[model samples]
Target: MREISLDRLRTLVAIADCGSFADAARALHLAPPTISLHIADLEERFGAPLLSRKRGQVRPSAVGETLVKYARRLLAEAEQALQDVKRQVEGKGGRVRLGASTGAIANLLPRALELLALHHPGIDLQIAVLTSQETLARLKSGALDVGLVALPQQATDGLTIKRWRRDPVMAFMPAGWKCPARVTPQWLAVRPLILNDSSTRFSRLTAEWFASGGQHPVPRIQLNFTDAIRSLVAAGYGAALLPQEAVAPVQDPRIAMRPLRPALWRELGIAHSAEDIDRPTQHVLDALWSLRLR
Candidate 1:
C-alpha cells in the first residue's frame, strides 16, 4: 500500500470536525467529490473503514479517532510552517539582524529602532554594536542584514551604501571653561584630549582631521564607550571630539559642546548587501529612511 497522504488525512480530520463531508469540502474550499475521494483514498491505504455515517451525519470510527488526533497535529504543523514562510515574505514577523558602530548606537539609532518596534510590532530585531570595519565585514559575509556605518571615504564594491544623516563632530568640554563658540583644530590642539583609541574608523577619521591641521595633542585618556567619554568630559578629564547626536541625550550641567570650525562632520549611512535585499532588510531600511536624522 502507498504511504498515507497528508491531504487525505486532512480531509478525514476536516470532515470529522465539521461532522459532514459537504461541510468539510466547503471549509477546505474543495469540491465535495474531491473531499469524498480523499477520504476514500485514506481508507484504501489503511485497508479498513475510517468513517461511518448515520442519519445523514458523518462520524469517525474507532481507528479514525486515533488517526484524528495525529492528523490534527500534522495539519497544525503544516499550517505553522506556511505561516512562518509567509511571515518571512511579508517582513511582518521575522528576525532582522543588524550591526552598527558604537557611535551610531550612541546617536539616534535607538530612536529609529524604537520607532520600528512601535510601527512593525511583528518584526523581531537583533542589533550588534561593532566598529565600521567589523560591520562591513559581517555584512559582506551575510552575517548581518543591515548595517549602520560611518560613510567610507573609499568605494565599496558589493554593498549599497546611502547616507542616513550628517552630524557635526563637536568638542565636549567642561562647562565654565569659556571656550570659543566654535572650536578650531588649532584651538582644540592646545587642550588635553581624551581620544578613543585609533582602532575604530571614527577614531581614525578624527585622528586624520587633527593631523591634517598639524595638531597632535597629547592624549590624557583613552576609552571607547560614548557615555564613559561624556562622563569623563563632564568630570573635566579632558576634551573629546564626538558626533553631536552622541551628546544629545546628555543633560549634565558640567558638560558643554562646541561645534568644530570648518565644520568637521561624520556622515552616517546604512549599508546593505547589493545582491539580495531581503524583506527584513528592506523593512529596517524603510525605518531608517523615516528617521528625523535622515
Candidate 2:
C-alpha cells in the first residue's frame, strides 16, 4: 500500500467542501495540476475513486465521504498540537521572576500582574520588593529575570534597559496648610521636610531640587519607605516630596498633594539581563506595556 498523505487527504476534503477541483485549488492556493495530482495519488493508493464529478458540479464518492470525515478531525488535532508547542516555547507557561521597589510593588505592579494573570494564567509570576540598586545587582547575578527600577542604573555591559514611565514628584503637606497649585523648592525649603532616606534616588533628587534654588532644608524625619513618610505628613509632622504613585493612595484626611513648580518627575524603566531575556520575561514586559499609567 502507498503511504498515507495528509496533504492529499486535506486536498480531497477541500475539493469535496468547495465542490470542484478549481475551487479547491483557489482556496488552498495550489495550482490546478497539483490538486489533480493529489486526488489521483489518493485514488491510486486506496484503489477507489474519491470523487464523483458531472458537468458543473462535484461530490465526494462514498469512500471519499468516509475519508473526509476522518481528515477533518485529524487536521484539527494537528493544528492544536502546533499551537501547544508554540505556546510552550514562547514562555506562556513558564515562570517569570520580577523585581521592583516598594512603591512600584504597592502602586503599579498589582494592576499589571492582575492583567497578566487574566490573560496568561499559565505563567508563574514571582515578585520581589527591592531597592533600585538591589534590583540591578540581582539582575546582573542572574538572580532576577527582570526589574522595574529608576532610570540611569549603573552602566553595565549585560543589561538591556527601556524607559517605562515617568511619575511626577508631588509635594505632600498636612491638610489646612496654605500652598499654591504648584509648590516651589523655595517654598518647600521653609517647611519642615520628611524626606526619603539618603540611599533612595528620591532623596538625591529632592536634595538637588532644593540646592538648585540655593537652599537646603534638613529633614525632621528620614525614612526609606514612602508609606511611612506619607504617614508622617498626614499626621502633621512634616511635608514631603513624593512620587505621585506614593501620594495618590493615602486615605488619611490630613494629607494634601500638590504638583511641584517645575514639575519634577522620576523616570522608571525596565531592565533585563542581556543574556537572559527569555520568553517569560518578555511576556511580563508585554503585560506592562499594555497598561496606561499616570
Estimate the TM-score of every prediction. Answer: 0.74, 0.65
Clashing pairs for predicted structure model 2, backbone only:
none
Q: Give the alpha carbon lDDT tens digit for every residue of 120-169 in model 1.
A: 77878888988888888898898988888888645678888888888788
- Give the distance in Å from residue 90's predicted Cα in candidate 1 to where it truly belongs: 3.4
For this target, which candidate reaches the highest TM-score against the unseen true structure?
A: 1
Off by over 4 Å in 1: 1-5, 8-74, 292-294
lDDT of 2 by residue, 226-282 (tens): 778878898899999878864245467888888887778888888888774667678
* lDDT score for residue 17 of model 1: 92
